[model samples]
Target chain A: MKTTAALSRLFAGIQADLDLVDKTFQERATSGLDILNTASMHAISSPGKRLRTALTLLSGKLNTYRFQKLLLLSVAFEMTHLATLIHDDIIDEASTRRGHPTVNALWGDKISILLGDYYFAKTAGLIADIEDPRIDHLFSDTVATVCEGTILEIMTSGNADLSQETYFEKIKNKTACLFAACSKGGAIISGASPEEIERLHAYGQHLGIAFQIIDDILDYTQDQSTIGKPAGNDLRQGMVTLPLIYALEDESQNGYRQQVQSLLTQTTHKEEDITAIVGWVTRGNGVKKSLLDAHAHGNKAREALYHFPPSPDRDVLDELIDFVLSRNK
Target chain B: MKTTAALSRLFAGIQADLDLVDKTFQERATSGLDILNTASMHAISSPGKRLRTALTLLSGKLNTYRFQKLLLLSVAFEMTHLATLIHDDIIDEASTRRGHPTVNALWGDKISILLGDYYFAKTAGLIADIEDPRIDHLFSDTVATVCEGTILEIMTSGNADLSQETYFEKIKNKTACLFAACSKGGAIISGASPEEIERLHAYGQHLGIAFQIIDDILDYTQDQSTIGKPAGNDLRQGMVTLPLIYALEDESQNGYRQQVQSLLTQTTHKEEDITAIVGWVTRGNGVKKSLLDAHAHGNKAREALYHFPPSPDRDVLDELIDFVLSRNK
Candidate 1:
């Protein structure tokens, strides 16, 4: 309810454009085969934040809003995002996202793999039609970074000794890069100056960092009903995210640190242990410190929007930072 | 030895360029991360037919033969092929290919998925550098078709009643499209005339169909040591390939057809039954009939090349049809 209200408020200016992005995505994503159509429809019909699309549109609105180009770009970005999620669920062995069954859960891993690849192929087709070399490079390069970031995260999975800098690096590649591409690509299409494009890119990168940090925090702080998946999934999957990193680094939480250390180093995780660590991180100033970092990034995102003159789109872009920080799911 | 000799004879003209493609594929496919680099190295070090690379280069040779552009295109095509194989191995639950362990066999499906995506990302980066909308569209569109083809195959996977037309459709999309892209993309880069481009594209399409049919044929006739994987894997996996389809449709082999039908349509496949079917396919008219179809497609590919005047590269391309048809593994 809170997220819906916030999205309605945030996307009020661009709802029609967002709807077009959604529609174009659905039509383009379908393969016209029964199983693929049904599976893709299920994945596409799910409610997503559409933050990337909003950023692209709002960024374009700041200048000459090229609806057609921006629409294609937004659809490409969101489709790419969906493709990654489908593949990530396979990697995460996740059954659900946002209270809905994942493509992997419903169709099995083989179909999920092909479906993800199909989306990626569709995304490439869309990117090809855009015809802008710069945008093309941005989209493809960002996807590569995202893949590398995922590899980095998997490599560091269960490593309790992961540094703060490494966590930042992982999130930057995995999440922030796509956000950067969205804003940067939008700006490019809208004829924004190089300096403005840089600013929007920065805005998106910081916003994405804040977004992922809050997501990590919510894993420790929110429940399945609220966050739409079980809490502490990161820990359950042996993922060492922001809150756990903070908790591990905090000398003040030495007792909880040992508990998390064992949990992280153990060959296998137990349900009760994951629950207990989620409790410890929630109470041991980990979430509090992570929130501070999230706020810092949020502030950085806000600063990126300062160059643009005061406008409705600008205001929405500004409010998006708060939404990123505050959203439960 | 025969295969190596054939490759040497066929690639004598373009061995330097082909060598450069190998060197470049190695450098670009690397992520500089240890695990990915190691896994990618393992995949790269294994000997692949590199027929796609040869097709791209030889196609270019027919015209301007832009060395650098063709090199990039070849690498991208091969990498795309590699990425698909990585993912396909996961879907097929394949333990090995060509006497080497698969990425999935070594690192598990999660790593294989990321590695495949990483290769795909790398391919995109290379494609972006090419700066041609036509090439970009071709690469992406071919990949999409390939994914669709794979999905089509999976959907038809246990259906004993699948039609020959549908089988043709699946292989065309899955295999021939990529081949067509390579040849046609090479022609486009070389500034081949539209008519020449279409001819080369048709040549590739027919050639790929012949190649895949032979592959399907080998699955029944070749032993594990000879083929690098066990024979009858298609039957084991419930995949109805050309030979199986042929055997089923052959009215003269009614007794064998019933046995094969029971094996295919049954809830579970047994080892002995699979062995029995492989023997039946070898003895029945299925292999002979499938071979005739392969030859028919091979002749069409040869006819498509009739437009090109005789040259060493043309001859090599011509011999490639024979090589593809006659190779034991």
Candidate 2:
């Protein structure tokens, strides 16, 4: 939680502009229908770190760019992220987000689904008005990647034999693809050199993958109240996140593999089963192995930012790398 | 059933190009995820009249244009239309479409949701490469409208007091907006005169509104086998379409209103109630009034196209105006 304050401090230079993106997003999401407006408001009104939007703003400082268009693109990326979350809640049947009831919980799954669609459309509408074909391509391709990754995750759910390669592919699609697009798109709109764009894109990729790993890790380590989501909820729901994947692969933890496998196949789990699984996952070297992976990715993300000479923007990005990996430090 | 041949004939000049749109769209909607690929292939493979794609191709012939780009844009429009249908089925909890099992039925709501999103992203990817901001603007704006419209429809599903004005607004957003964008976008891409673009857009608007009216009326009038959907489906689901709105307003049908209203408010409806409502809708002036409304809009659609000098494309469009309003003729 202290890392959030650190993350906020990193955005101090561009706080006002980030707020503008927030204001613009809220103001634009209204559909003029009462129910839709209510649902849309509920979705955007929820507290999010807005990390992706911040990345866009921070990246824009690296070069000369149209400030308003950059903000719009940033909002576009945030909206797409929000869109995915709305659908994700439905897919997960999640009851809360940021400690507030989700759109699916407040409204029904039907309205939630449509509101998710609305956000995706709203994102496209934002970028479609921008003249940069590269940004358009990046945003749409990222959308494809996100959806494809999610569908793959859904398809592979409950399989204990899922590989590390497949897990990386899934998380990259569901999380890193959009992050890569955010940084790359910001660079493109800023008229950065092609090489710089590629570097930032790679930076965002590593950062996003590491970020998701921390998220899954925190699901096991953090309190349910702190995360605003049920702890080990993924395991109970038959989802195979990185932590569980590592536990399954650890020879040292093989004693509990059959127990975890049996729990995975169970459609209904006792609360005790979840507790036992979490205990084993934490006690094993799985969490350590996962953290080691995140550290490596965090290092790679920092290496990608080496292209930019020291500036406030690059410094802020470096701080974000620390923020993402700060769980250990 | 008879209207099918006439609608196809309306695309006579662009039959081959329309086929190319179909082939291109089918080839492109695949996401390489086996489940998504199967679902998408199922969606595109199901027999659709492909009227929206035809409209784009026909509208392009109003002036000389970049032929392949126009075809691609047509495919883009069709894909967007299909994306909306996929989401709509989930919202409706529909089991079948066009006499075939829907993606939702085959896979589940979760996969259906992602596949629908995949199609939307695919459409954006197609237009993002087109090098035209107008096409991008049209595509995204239409997406927003379709979603907002559907959300509004979902919110108002059980309300018996829905107004005719609201009904038209809903249909315009849900259906006409995409149709309007298709024609207008095709004209923009083809470099048609502003007047021609406006005329075609208005034509599409009127045509789409009438098309939806016919769809509602067919629910009351057509056989289950002919329409591929259950009769009185909208009424059973508590949807008050144009015919129902007209029936409720009819002075001669005053007695049925109380009974109909009661039935609507019930969460689970009896088939007898659906039968009674459908009988009243057809036997009363409801279907007549709805058909009369369709005819008026159909006439207006035809009038918009009169601004164009007669050509094979123009003739085909004129025939479409008839196809939309035709029930028996």
Candidate 3:
């Protein structure tokens, strides 16, 4: 398990390129409209881990590095992720993200919806500027998949009947698919062969699944301040994530399934009820089982990395898998 | 002004191709998921006037008509329009559009948001399939401009002090830009000369402005049964459109401006208050003034069309300008 400092240092090889991506991201977010510029600037001010950006840069390095094209691709993917998050916050009615007020919380749903859309438009423009048909197709299909994944999540909300297969499907659509695109897109722009592109794509998919599983687990185990959101937030929203799915399947836990069903169907979740469910999931082997599944994915991601010769960028990606597994938030 | 039957006959030459566009639109709306397919199908089912489709087809006809490429472009533009309408309903909190329940009204805002995004993704994928960089840039820029226009409209919603220049800017961004893209896209695909493309772009832009001006006018003058939505609908939402703008500017109207100012600042608009304001605007030169402005743009559109040699498609486009000016709904 890497410490936060160690995790931050993992990307030392691509740190400069990642910094350039951040700069480009901020520049791309600027708009001619005062309100749009301000809101968009605020939206990108609190940056994420930039894991996708790193994946893109690192994957590009695996073949022939095209720094300029990779930078634009990285920015586009990051913008796409940001757009989805703004819209997601609207659906979740989340007031804050990463300890900062959400666009939805600050500007209202209408503004947030427009801002998310603005980011999407900006992303499309950037992809078009890249002018690669394959990248264009990959990006378009990935975004569509992300939307489908979100739709699937909304449709399956409150169903304790959600299966492991369906859970995998949802995460793949919502999270892993974009990760795959980042890697594959990087590979394509760097002129990597098709087989190599597929390998990186596989690598990103497994890493993304591991990342989302950890996120779901942290939702149960972490407190509000740590995760920057309420614990059991997904459960409160009636989202049947992997841990809850496993927890409910454990019939040995004294009618716990009925408790979950009741909680899922509740009109409004009381805080204590959410706490109790979180405890049940954590106390049972749900978090541990989810962790094991994440580790299995992490191993697959590592195996994908082994297909390429060892390089500094590959080491950072390998360490990223560990970071995904071990991070508390 | 052409009769309804005559207007329907305007696109007779391209009717078969337009039918194919509708078929493509329907096929593209389908998804593997039942809920998405159902919601998306419903969204596209209540089709608005396919004026954009006609613009694309007619512009293509002015050059070497590439029906296949133009068909895809038309469908993409139509889907883009559908996607915007779905999101617009969310912002407006609108229940019915085109005498049918909006996706936002039936499926809720969350699903509607995702479905809109799914359509956008589908649009992007279709554009990528066309593999034309110029088209790619045009489509991306057009979508972004639409978002900017929508944001501008929301920002200026309650401000009765919004300038006519700004109003023109808003409509151009929100409506005319896409129309320009439709015509320009058609011309580009059909291998039109640069000068011819510019003329078509200009034609579409002016026509779109005229079209939206008529739409705004209809919102003020038409009834719920006529327009499929309530009259003064924009004003109810605090949208200061052309007629209202002109009425507010009419200082000689003996305190009518005060009535409008007071109404604009009201927290909740009463039905009768809206009706009274509508009557004031109609009685004054507001609607008439707005109609003159529509005609001015309509003339400019006609001028752009006259640059091209007389052809069957060109004649249909010429009638289309009259259709834009005279349409009640």
Computed on C-alphas against the true complex, the DockQ of each candidate is: 0.73, 0.79, 0.81
**lDDT at residue A141 of model 2 (Cα atoms):** 88
For candidate 3, write residues A33-137 as lDDT tens digits: 888888888887874547888899889999999998998999999999999999999998889997899999999999888888888888888998898999999
TM-score of each model, in listed order: 0.96, 0.97, 0.97
CAPRI-style class, candidate 1: medium
Candidate number with greatest TM-score: 3
Model 2: residues >4 Å from true position, as ranges? A327-329, B1-3, B327-329
Interface C-alpha RMSD, model 1: 1.1
Instruction: Provide the global lDDT of candidate 3 against the true structure.
Output: 0.88
lDDT of 1 by residue, A201-308 (tens): 999999999999998999999999897889888887878998888887878677776677678767677889888888888888789999999999999999989999
Q: Which ten residues in a row have the lowest lDDT in candidate 2 chain A?
A: A1-10
What order do you get sorting by lDDT, best first?
1, 3, 2
Error of 2 at B196 (Å): 1.7
Least well predicted 10-residue stretch by lDDT in candidate 3 chain B: B1-10
Q: Measured by TM-score, how close is model 1 to the native structure? A: 0.96
The residue-level lDDT of candidate 3 at A319 comes to 83
Instruction: Pick the winner on TM-score between candidates 2 and 3.
Output: 3
**lDDT, model 3, position A51:** 82
